[model samples]
Target chain A: MDLSDVRRHHLSVVLEHLVCSGPRSRAAIAQETGLTKATVSTLITDLLDRGLVQELDTPTAGRVGRPATDVGAAGHSVGALGLEIDVDEVAACVVDLTGTVRTVHRHTAGNRDVTARTVIHRLRDATQRAMADAAHMGIDCIGATLALPGLVDPNEPTLFVAPNLHWFDADLRSLATQLRLPEHFPITMDNEANLGALAELRHGAGQQFDSFVFVSAAGGLGAGIVLDGRLLRGAHGFAGELGHVVVDPSGKPCACGARGCLETLLHSDVNPDELARHLADALRTVVHLIDPEAVVLGGSLAAFGDEFALAVADHLHADTLGARWHPCAVRRSTLGADAALVGAATAALDRIISDPTIVPTRALAH
Target chain B: MDLSDVRRHHLSVVLEHLVCSGPRSRAAIAQETGLTKATVSTLITDLLDRGLVQELDTPTAGRVGRPATDVGAAGHSVGALGLEIDVDEVAACVVDLTGTVRTVHRHTAGNRDVTARTVIHRLRDATQRAMADAAHMGIDCIGATLALPGLVDPNEPTLFVAPNLHWFDADLRSLATQLRLPEHFPITMDNEANLGALAELRHGAGQQFDSFVFVSAAGGLGAGIVLDGRLLRGAHGFAGELGHVVVDPSGKPCACGARGCLETLLHSDVNPDELARHLADALRTVVHLIDPEAVVLGGSLAAFGDEFALAVADHLHADTLGARWHPCAVRRSTLGADAALVGAATAALDRIISDPTIVPTRALAH
Candidate 1:
């Protein structure tokens, strides 16, 4: 790593430590990061100067040396606006550095039938309200994220396709332009499933796992592929597409013109035991491919709850050729419907913390 | 990243630049890595001292300032032993720092119904022969990777399940112990599909793509999921079990007991067009999920050649929503059936060059 990269990585590490572990002295950070005390002090001081960390006036007791002054993440003034454009709802919220949800506004309506212009305007209203709400809370919103239910170009904030929303090639970034956020306050546009997986990993069932599949079954079956604590957004950023996987080559046709897709099999009329068995069967392919630590079913699928868990268990265990298919744990999403909003917020906050330059207003003004 | 981690990262980067981009002077490296000339010099000196790099005699002109000494990866003396235990054959080879495949020995035979002990013995023979061949070439074998046909526990280098070999939870480290190469000469055991994908990505069809699916179809269909240039080995090192993906919920039963799995469908009796259609169906799922740049068909499936490509292309292009399903270029694996062997070799070579400590026999002795 270069000198600048070293500084950046250290800054991120120190900030993460503070946010996750609460206040800690420089010595504690050094021990945790395996950096020298001098280096840790330098990084922490740099962060403090950047307003990313705060010195706790109250001294901490536990230490190898003198009672050391504690420092914690101080990016309290900066929050992120997270917006999700789903088939069933248009959700917006503000998330702080500690990942606490501050203000949440949800517009529950069928997103499928809405015109692109109307939805964008509605989203604009929600975003403005979210920003206004954050301002009311005295938190300066820096970065924002618009999580959509479709394939997105990570490099471009353009919605390539939203089968559920019936929006294709819609320039989602136009909303950012309308919002008039500064260029440096980067806005990320991505699949809601990806962010939902990230949120679950950070604050929900996946906290214990570095690798797991987060399946968000709503209007469609979307998967958030997390390997090694990192969400897998393939080369084109269209990953975790569980809904389109052909489960039955001869079954019903799909929106993508495919037959026997997993999406077609998942419906309200489907039997719970049969749905669980089918879901488990589909999941087995994922399990066989990426033997994950666990499969956390999120979104509307979370409604399946314990019954779904039991059915998945039965099918997964059925694969046991004595020990070849030792079933991994199956669980429901703890965040339920809020996974996407929380994840979008977390992703934006992470970007701001990792590179404060992106949080333009605060960095330049400070 | 701490001081040591920083040093390690720079060392790997420098060595990679040398091996991949050919030799470069310290000034060029500094420019490329955005490191100070002094830092590059220190890192280069450390590598030279460790005998992982050597100062090149010919200094080139395009460099700024003085024609600084050009250094390149000097681990040609150390090599990696790569072994592939497949359902159809046992393959082993020695790969050097420049990724040159030196000695290859393939024991072609049906791998089904073999005892783990017997297969291990055969692999040991091939591994010993490959190492002996490398020794004859005056190169020292430093690290080894054994690629198998099932789920692997990365932490233990043990086989979790090899449905094709009927090996379940078999302690594969026994091969390492039985071969008894060296204490510090690290050994990696992983699924063949993962290795095959890595091989294809490194040396064959996938170099152009940061993400792609490598389908190794022999007796069964296995996918190696690569996303954003990193291979996805789910939590248990068992990501990419495409063969077990339920293709038909009520089709033929598989070894894993699931009906209509991709594995059960890949039999010789299935027409080539039908097989391609089935494979295309599976590839569509991956495409919708990750939107990879290309899908490279490897292993026995490559034998189908243009016929397979035509079928996949036909099906993929059939989804002509014009935007939702943009058919990514699909082609046969350039490495064909040799992909797994090459991948195993490349993976091992990568390990040795990245960390010379694993080259205990050469690094320590020298």
Candidate 2:
């Protein structure tokens, strides 16, 4: 403790209560959080002025004197900008405090045909347009996150490599600067799969499974592992590289120069049964290693329907070591193609949701 | 939180400071933890009364005025018991607060030839003797943990399944009663691989790499995964079943009714070159999924010397997708065969280290 730490802690407690328990009276928040009523009222006032929370019209009408007004997280006052640069398309979206996507912009482009710089500029332009829309709607953009289809530098705004994107060691900071984001607005970059996993955790399959492995296969095969309600971005942020795992040692060479990797089996002419077998084989390894509760298939694979998921699940069940006792479910992604963009936006908003004190109050707002 | 929560939090901070930073003066601890000198003095007094910490004779000789006494974690005053039930033997040991093994007893026997009840009794006898040893040394055993070579019920003292031990749904609570441990002396059960990973984390390879996978092949092939300095026990505590992961899908049938598991390639007559290839294949999948920083070979497999490890490492490096950027090392276990036992004891002691307030004061001690 410092004074600011205590203030932020109290503010977060009140904000999280409304976010998790729906609207609640200030007195109820005090009782639930074990804070004094006076303290709760002061914290609620701070949150209300910051545009992070709003007073609801509903009152404690049942057998109560001078009805207490309910408070809740503000819906449209603030939002986060999420940008994605995929292999074939550029997308941008703004997500509000309640995890609702308010605006979306998608542009199909020959991303691989153009230089990495050109794709970056295109994504930047999309982000600029999204910001304009957010400002026009009076949605205070608290932060922004760019979802890239590659290995992101855990320490810097850089992309280590995106084999499918034909890019290596790309600078993301320059792009952030080009967007001319508000100073100290906290723009960052993350891997697409990781962000997609975050999106699923906040808005989709997360309701059913707290721990899962999100597998996406639109432009490339990748995985995002969530365990105990948090994303598992391993020792160098390269934890879920499911595509490169060698499924067949004597099989065809992959784009990453590996022989018989999981990606090699996803050829257009490949049979579903063969792909299912290979996918099950690789997923079995993942289940054995991390032991997630469910396997959520996203990207183009979710469109394969229930039968495909069943086949993969069948193989997984047959060979899983403790399948009889430890059951693992396999299902399709609820968000489908929108998972990555939504996840990117969710990641941006989480910066504020996790620390409400970071938001400037109305008096300080420019 | 309540008053007790605040008290425990402060106590934990003071105890952890001594454990992690060595001996420190009261003023130094208060400065480090940001607690007032009066509060630190009260917490330290409480810890002293509970036999968790001791004041050292060393004084601030170079400082002005009266010399300030140093306080540090008490090594011999308190300890935890660790019991192990392996395929061929029963082992028990006591580990003091400093993580040093004080007493160890290993009884080698043909455990497979006996009934589950008979083996349980045998382990009970070993635990009884270890408790006597601990008592003779005037060490208060705060807790006890049993390590088994199978799935441990995370919520109970039950052993879900120990395939090699020929045990299923073993009633560990009954065994706990038979040992007649002190009242409120917490006793728990955990998987051998999980404990081994914990041991490696606190005392062995954990010093070098915060995250690594401990692969052991003595009784059977098992892996204990540690990521970001914590064990990655998947949903249902069934993670790290490396032995059962299918390696040669078209090869021989495994004992688990699965065809071509990693364990099948580890037969006595199997060629090292072929075995290394299969192990590497399975490990490549593990690497892609969890991305641990190192792979630690333990038990019988570690005795294969540097050549076998190097062969496996070479194959793993050659095929791992992000090998060029994210490097993973392969090494032998530092604690060797004793990892599980030490880890079990450490896990037992962690119960107190994490919450020192739980330990009754000396005046309330039995």
Model 1 per-residue lDDT tens digits across residues A213-233: 999976778899887878878
List lDDT for all candidates, in order: 0.76, 0.83
At residue A352, give the lDDT of candidate 2.
75
DockQ of candidate 2 compared with the true complex: 0.63
Q: Which residue pairs come into collision in candidate 1? A: A239-B289, A289-B239, A289-B240, A289-B241, A290-B239, A291-B238
Candidate 2 stretches with Cα past 4 Å from truth are A2-7, A17-43, A58-70, A363-366, B1-4, B20-42, B57-70, B363-366
Where in model 1 is the C-alpha error above 4 Å? A21-27, A55-71, A108-110, A180-184, A320-326, A356-366, B21-32, B36-75, B108-111, B320-326, B356-366
Tens-digit lDDT track for model 2 on B185-271?
688888888889899878887667878999977687889999877788888788898888777667788877777788878764687
Q: Write the per-residue lDDT of candidate 1 for residues B1-366, one digit (tens) a residue.
A: 356777777778777777666777888888997778898888777776666678878746685766667787774576778898888788899877766688899997777888888877777778888888988888877678888888786677678778778777787655677775666567888778889998887778888887788989866678887877678776657677777666667787877776777778876478888887777766666676666778888877778778778788788767523324445878789887778887887787787456654443224334
Score candidate 2 by TM-score against the native.
Answer: 0.92
- Give lDDT: candidate 2, residue B350: 86
Provide candidate 2's TM-score on chain A. 0.90
Looking at model 2, give its docking quality level.
medium
Residue A53's C-alpha lDDT in candidate 1?
Answer: 71
